[model samples]
Target: MGRVKVLGACPLDCPDACSWVVTVEDGKATGLRGNKDHPVTRGALCVKVNRYLEQVGSPDRLRYPLRRVGPKGSGRFERISWDEALDEIATRLTGIVAGFGAEAIWPFHGTGSLGYLQGLEGYPGRRMFNVLGASHHAATICSVAGGTGLRYTLGTSGGMDPEDFARSKLILLWGTNPLTSGHHLWKFVQDSGAYLVSIDPVRTKTSERCDEHIAPLPGTDAALALGLLHVIVSLGAQDERFIAEHTEGWPEFRDRITEFTPERTAAITGVPQEQIVALGERIARTRPTAIRASQGMQRHAGGGMALRVLACLPGVTGDWAIPGGGLHYSTSGHFRLDDAALVRDDLLPHPVRTLSMTRLGEALLETDDPPVKALFVIGANPVGSNPDQRRAIEGLSRDDLFTVVLEHFATDTVDYADIVLPATMQPEHLDVIAGYGHLYLVWNEPAVEPPGECLSTTETFRRLSHRLGLTEPALYDSDEELARQLLKGHDLDRLRADGFLKIQPGSVPADKLQFVSTRAELAGHDPLPDYTPPADKGDGLVLISAASHYFLNTSFGSNPELRRRAGDSTITLHPDDAAARDITDGAAVLVSNARGAFEAVAEVSDRVRPGVAATTKGRWAKFTDGATVNATIAERDSDYGGGAVFHDNRVEVRPR
Candidate 1:
């Protein structure tokens, strides 16, 4: 590979799965940048992804397999051959299965590497483990509540394209900081000349740029949505024609929201009554308004209900029928790939137990009947990402438990692993990527080979299956075959040539909706969402583990350059709250609740609401003095999707 240009896609889990152009020189990639022809990414990359070439070839990259040679969590290991590592893993897993049954073994992974082959819905690794009858991972840490709840009203999470934002007169930047997370889409919103409104508990970068910033109380988004509906109903602005043609439960829903008046909504949410009335009027009067809902708002106890209510707003204004309208949660459903072809669930010997990845601490420490004895961790760093961090670490420290991790760097989770295997990056692997924000479908091809003994996630699983004596043909499926399966309707040769293709193609907006008649996807689900109060509330302040601009949930935290720019994991508090507690700005403080505690430097400012405290989450323990926000975060599940309630954390803060 000498001075060759290679087309690829970003494998990180994000709305904008950007397409990239990699410059390979002397058998290694020298430069990586966004593809100018790509529509959503628009020849630009985020702060974390812009330095992709540097990150892939970092000095600290794990290049070979290693076995623990010191105490657990000591970050000590001895180099080992891939064959020996796989053999030992196979032997230990077999023993665990023989003694504790298949349910005792769990495969832990996340969207850190979200390529179609290596991402969420498995191409081979999932099939191999399903054949082996390992515990089913609910993989609900992110996107669960937003996807599940939006479907309850819209029947599908797919909606108007981010490009459609150019046609809108109004936009709601709800619960998301698109400036950092979806930077590409933010340009479309800005160019559209739309009146942007931001709704969040703190004054985020998106909020600061908005024409109106509505700071609602944490977990009170459902109530605020209901209040908007109340004002719309009172003004008789409901789209009756669209309602008569497409909706069913409008009357019942109308009656239910009579209780949530604007005044009541103002009381529930911290926003003023006048602002609620004004915002509701804008929503009712605005044409082709798009509600850009994010997953953070739904990280509360009532996360599911909030999205359900937000999903129904488009129906009231008939926004679903227009360009730059309707709610955009995720466009992942638009791919319509042959999942059965990629994931061979039929190979399972029988149905196995399902474990929620959000409850890893409980699964490891509390489960009695065949507790998780063997765990294979990949594509995630649970010690830094999962809730109840202390408890999860305590469980990982158990002598009888065996843990395996595959990675490019020694993450906090790798510190406790019995066997650590070297893993390949996107530039050195093959996979496909689809956007949750745009209509593009990208194919990521290998640009360069792994430098050392590093291997792809799919190859690692195939090798392990071979060593375990698993003889399923499905376990040996090729990457190209799975890629062909996903690109069934499209022209394969053209897709390969372009390196990207639009999954949803249409000249009209209605083309996205599968059900023109608005109704819940599942039976027994409330067609009309109700206003639910906060689950955890008190006189004490609420702490939200907000996402940092440079780091995506424990994925890019290992990058030293990115870490330097992110600064420390400091907490921000309202001046009133800080004054009441006598806490000084920039001083180290304890953010604690009944369940757990963590330390953070406090920044006393009025940017946050009086009753709320906010801090950037996903900092690794090593950078933060063996501390993280997850230490205090409860393992509470969302209302419906079994999602982790990361924002449902309530704590009292005081200077140390």
Candidate 2:
């Protein structure tokens, strides 16, 4: 028996690139756990990663390359040799390029494979496509809007570490519920000793545990944020000295917030005027106050503006100077890694045409002339995650188009593919990870050989490149060489010895008012936080798509344990709303909008605000006639970032 080595870092979309330890008996992996010696994660494991054994060895896993035996989206396929699959894909794709312009071919991908090497920058796909002048995709689905907003206000999107939460006197969990989505950061929140204030339209698990819960009207977050700023300024709590020294646009920003009196903001936000005043006073009076915004606020129309408004709070009070008092969008310490050096741009012949992942439906179906002739889906399941199920299905169902999916299982997106390429799980690959939420860079070693012909993403690309006749210097190398190249200029000996590397820390400004003077130094847009209201408040009820505690998109929906934990999708409605509609808990109800309708189990809970309905977003599409929660959402996007307006939808629900 030999100690099974756990490779640190796996999963493309996750921020916590945790290290795992494998136990091997007779050359077979028997168990896996977190590497306790890793300082950042500290041996913590999320439920998704804990079930690696089943995921890697499941009988349902895709074990070999398979080509379509029937029509597209038919889920009928016949096993094909790897050589045949690669050769056929390359030949067909090349022909499409020869006929149509490079822009005619769109490669749609998202954050599913966050590893720089496995995805855009590190992968040879971008290089190959660029050389062929193929269409490129702009990976801006989840955090781009929020990232843009932060870049405008803070100069940099990176923020203070989550472990520094212990130094705060007050922490406002604005529109973010970390208990469910970011469990790794919860430890610091729980130990912070600060008063937790949850301000959201729904009463989530994070809100339930907070010292105070402020339920604002949907899309009225900017109004609430402005009202608080007004109160802070009125009380003379603004850090004038810090502002004068660090920031630039104070006078104009101050004048803009004058209109957001507590009374005026309360009317629009559904929060009490007195409560707003008190919260503002507390934020100003607290020795060190922190405001945390999450992706939820960035999912609606004007979402970027909402986040920009919230980012100004820390600046107004000069809270950024405090160790724990600052605006934090993410604590994943990915910026510490020298990504520029790791990204080998010269490997590609030219830049590929790009498309936005958020508007995948539009990009795939609405393109003029030679539309997306072939799609290579890797590390993403847009069929389940993209908004508007009808539109996504229509886009993916191009009759003449060929689709290929590289996956570990038969996901909702796999059914639409013409070919399925078996992919290896995390423990079966050699890789490196730079966690965005933490400062650890992990060296992922192959704990076990890929089972039954499963291949790493790097391997898949290597074979594909070979078939395509790509002769670039970078594309012709092995995975180990790629890793070494990416890790260039670093202390590799140290990383290999510890199995991880923590980037050296740097000096961060301690003066909360630094931005007041250094506003011009920030990265993008207006430095001062700004506020804007939603375009419309429809007569129909407002709908919000939130994540569940048990699943991450549609990826884990099929996991038996997770499925048991999250039995079925249910609509959470306020008692008043449910009663008005004659709906009761456990009753089946039809939720409909202009796009389409679907039946969902009703769970009448006061967790939601009146006139607002809530449901989990990542359930399987087949939950009800291929009915997805996103189907009820329109393509209406935010004015600034064009982010999906999931929170701005209007729908009606009735008993089924």
Candidate 3:
């Protein structure tokens, strides 16, 4: 046996961008640990990183490319050679383009694979589609709403570094559970001397550790933010000089927020008037107060407005000038990947149709003249992640549509695929990752040759490009070359030598008080964060879905150990609400809404508000009994950001 080979950079589709030192003997991975030298992750990793070997070596992993031998959505396929697979895909896509024009073909992808080659950067999918003049999807499924809202208020959503948490005097965890979803960030928060406050519909693991937990009604975040602003202004906390100098439309914004008194906000948000007043006072009293807002708050009908309102808090108090005070969102800046440069339109033969990622099912099933004849899916699980699983299934089940899925395992999406291409595991590929939550761009070297016939996404695309005669020499370059291209203006040599790179921090202008007055404000929108309730609020209990630490969508759900760790999907309800519905803890209950229904074990607790219910997302589709959480969520979105309103749904629960 030789010395174990440690691999850095294993893609888990997570924001951590974890660097792993894989202990290998005789070409077999023995164990894994976090690379202490990695800049972003430091020496830490979540529980998932340790269990990656099991996932990579799982028996369920796809070993070879396979073509469907039975009906679509049926898990029946026969193994095919790489040549045959590439040939088949190329032929089908060409025919689709020739007949329906380039717009008829759609490439659906996201953060499934963190490597630049597989995602938006290195892949030719978007380039080909764009060159072909295919309809381009806006592609803002996750953070678009928050991004839009923040853009309007602050010009950008960027905030303080996670490491700077140690400097904060007051930390407001709004609609996020860093303890679970953001484990590493939680460590910084724990060590920080900051007084922690958690606000959400449910008392998450994060809330449990907080100094105070405020359970607000779902979808009322904007109202609460307005109330807080009202308190801050009323208590004379506003930086009037800064507000007058830096911001635009201040008079109108001030006039607008004057009506959002604590009493008025209490009724709208379901938070006690005293709690609102106390929180407002805390914000006013605390120096360098920081607010951490996540996607949770932006998954409602008026979610974008909520984020905009929350972002205005720090600015209103001139908190953005402080090292640890500001509204924080995504950390995608730590590892910068310029997508526009990678997309070359000259390579494609025609224009392609655009599709909405949010309406994946509808797009797939649409019977337009040319139709969505062919689909190329990479690094995403639309069936599991998209809203309305039943509709997604029906769309994928279309007999005439040809589908290709590149994955390591048989996901819910794979069952409907016409061709399943085996994909290399993270440790088996050479890649680079930049976290959206922290500052670090870590390089990952392959620990072992790709097992069996599996290939990396880059290799797959390269082979397909060669077969299609797309004469672009750059498309066939090595991963290293591609990485270099992707990191064009960035310092690649420094990143390589240091094992990570941190970008220079940008500054928020000194005079800007809030969204309306800041240069960072988004175009075609009011500068101040505004709020209005959704048009529809159904009768009965409101449903909200949150992320699960154990699973990333349905990927890790197949793992028995991970499944054991996650346990069964349970519906969380307030004790009083459960009793009123004649339900008890541990009892099987039926959760139904206008869209669909599902059954699960009920847990009654005071952690949640009386009118609301909560459940973790990323459970296996089969466990929902044909009804997933997205089914109940309305497809309607915030007008400004186009964010899905997952938390605005109203459902009823009954004893099953």
lDDT of 1 by residue, 328-411 (tens): 877876678777777777778999889899999999999968899998888889999998898899989988899999888899
Off by over 4 Å in 2: 119-124, 331-343, 347-352, 504-528
Q: What is candidate 3's local distance difference test score?
A: 0.76
Tell me how candidate 1 scores on lDDT.
0.84
- Candidate number achieving the greatest TM-score relative to the actual structure: 1
The worst-scoring run of ten residues by lDDT in candidate 1 lies at 507-516
lDDT of each: 0.84, 0.74, 0.76
Better of 2 and 3 by lDDT: 3
In TM-score terms, candidate 1 sits at: 0.96
Residue-level lDDT for 49 in candidate 3: 64
Question: TM-scores of all models?
Answer: 0.96, 0.94, 0.95
Give model 3's clash tally. Answer: 30
Q: What's the CA error at residue 30 for candidate 1, in Å?
A: 1.0
Q: List, residue by residue over 1-656, the lDDT tens digit for candidate 2.
A: 56646555655455567766777666677887877887656787777768868877788899999988876667888999898899899888888878876667666765565665665435435655655566767666677677666555655567766667778889998888777776666777778889999988889988989999999977889889899999999999999877887666788788888989999998989899999999999988996887778777777766776766777787778877778887777644334444544445454456555666777788777876667888888877887887777888888888777788888888778888987899887667777777666667777677777888788877787778789887766555676777676777777667766888877533333223222323333434444455556664667688888878777766676778877888777888899999898998999988888887767889999999897899887777754467778788776567555577777788899999
